[model samples]
Target: MMNMITDMKFLNFFKITACLVGIGVATSACAAGSSVLKIEEEKKVPKIQTIKKRDTASVAILGDSLAVGLYIGLTHLARKNEKLKVQKYSRVNTGLVRYDRYDWSKAAKKISQTDDSNIYILMFGANDLQSIRENSKAYHFQSKGWVKHYNERIDEITNAVKKPGREVFWVGLPIVGKSNFADGYQYLNDMFRARAKLNGITYIDSWDWFANSNGKFQMSGETADGKKRLLRAKDKVHFTPAGYADLGVRVAKEMQISN
Candidate 1:
């Protein structure tokens, strides 16, 4: 009964997250036809305007709600370093697929104008597991055509942020409380890792940071003092405040921000 309850919790969490992202359980059937879909050519990275260099430093945080949690954590840790200014450009519920709602490539250009700093922290894809509209065509999630279109968008966003003397830290998605959600994230993470490497950006793997000892999704994790604390929010999607702060500390350190 205990095992059954645990399994049910995982299933419920997966279904809820997928539904919230506008992906219905019926969408799983779309996966079968993915191989039959035609893949498009990957977009070439274009040259963006050269942003002004300044003595001041800033780190632009970009993505969806997960980026908001990441920003909250980064703000607490990065403020200690007076030289580093952490700015958030993330919009909640926005993803690479939802240009009609919000476009990160365009947002990146505007943010570059405001900050003009070299460092960037990008975390996306939590809200992107649904169908995507491309060139008057719609591609379902996990489809080969969807993969092609998604990669193109990722490249577009990455290129829009690249400037002279700039560094981008692309943070990968963390493991959620459901196996299906975890699988989706794993696919997204692989894309992030490959694309970040291809684009010469740093990719931050966050799966283990929120995973259990057995590499499973877990709600609680050990702090620096080895004391276990709740790291997940009730939704099992976003992080708790404590969880974000802890994760932010790691990110700040990775960005070389020290007081």
Candidate 2:
């Protein structure tokens, strides 16, 4: 009887040990599964932040028609990127400060904010190249110091946008086909580069990639996004949706800004 009882106790102890072992196996399996899930969860990249932090980044555009809406609806899409709050400060047929004293005065009065944290992206020279000499809108160029005034005006405009700590990106003029106007474009691009270096700003050279083998304004096939490059319409001066998206991609890449 005693031996039988001892045998029963031994079996009971074995059964208890088996139960503990099973529990440990289940616990270990659950832990391993949880670890794998956590690793997978960490891999996704977030595109936009719905809730803004205390510090908000603001960008403003200061250019001519390009800023006013020249390309593949790019500016609008860029503004809706679910990331940036982009504000365009473009005036058609207008540069940094128009040669017209009255227009410039009115433009200056319209200004309200000038903070360094405010980023400004500027492209100009399309209109300033036009001769508005002494109230003559039709005159292309008879002024003697046109280059000098244009350069100085661009400098002043750049400095104004600087806002002490504000970031500035000045996109250079593109190469154009058959537009003797491109000479002015090249001169303006050179000036922009010099001024950017002087003020420690980023000078984006659109002319480099936008130029064709003939050294004129040409689209690189379709923009990186499969959109055809015809957004400039027949004018080939502005961007199509595809074109702007392509430009936006380049801009985002340069600035390391999110989409």
Give the Cα lDDT of each candidate: 0.79, 0.59
List clash counts for every candidate, in order. 0, 8
Q: Which residue pairs show backbone clashes in model 2?
A: 71-239, 72-239, 72-240, 72-241, 116-166, 175-217, 176-217, 231-240
The CA-based lDDT of model 1 is what? Answer: 0.79
Q: Write the per-residue lDDT of candidate 1 for residues 167-217, one digit (tens) a residue.
A: 788999988986668788899999999888778677889888888889888
Indicate which candidate wins on TM-score.
Answer: 1
Compose the digit string of candidate 2's lDDT tens values, residues 52-110. Answer: 23234566766777665522244555565755566666677776435563343234325
- Worst ten-residue run, lDDT, model 2? 45-54
Evaluated against the true structure, the overall lDDT of model 2 is 0.59
TM-scores for all predictions = 0.75, 0.64
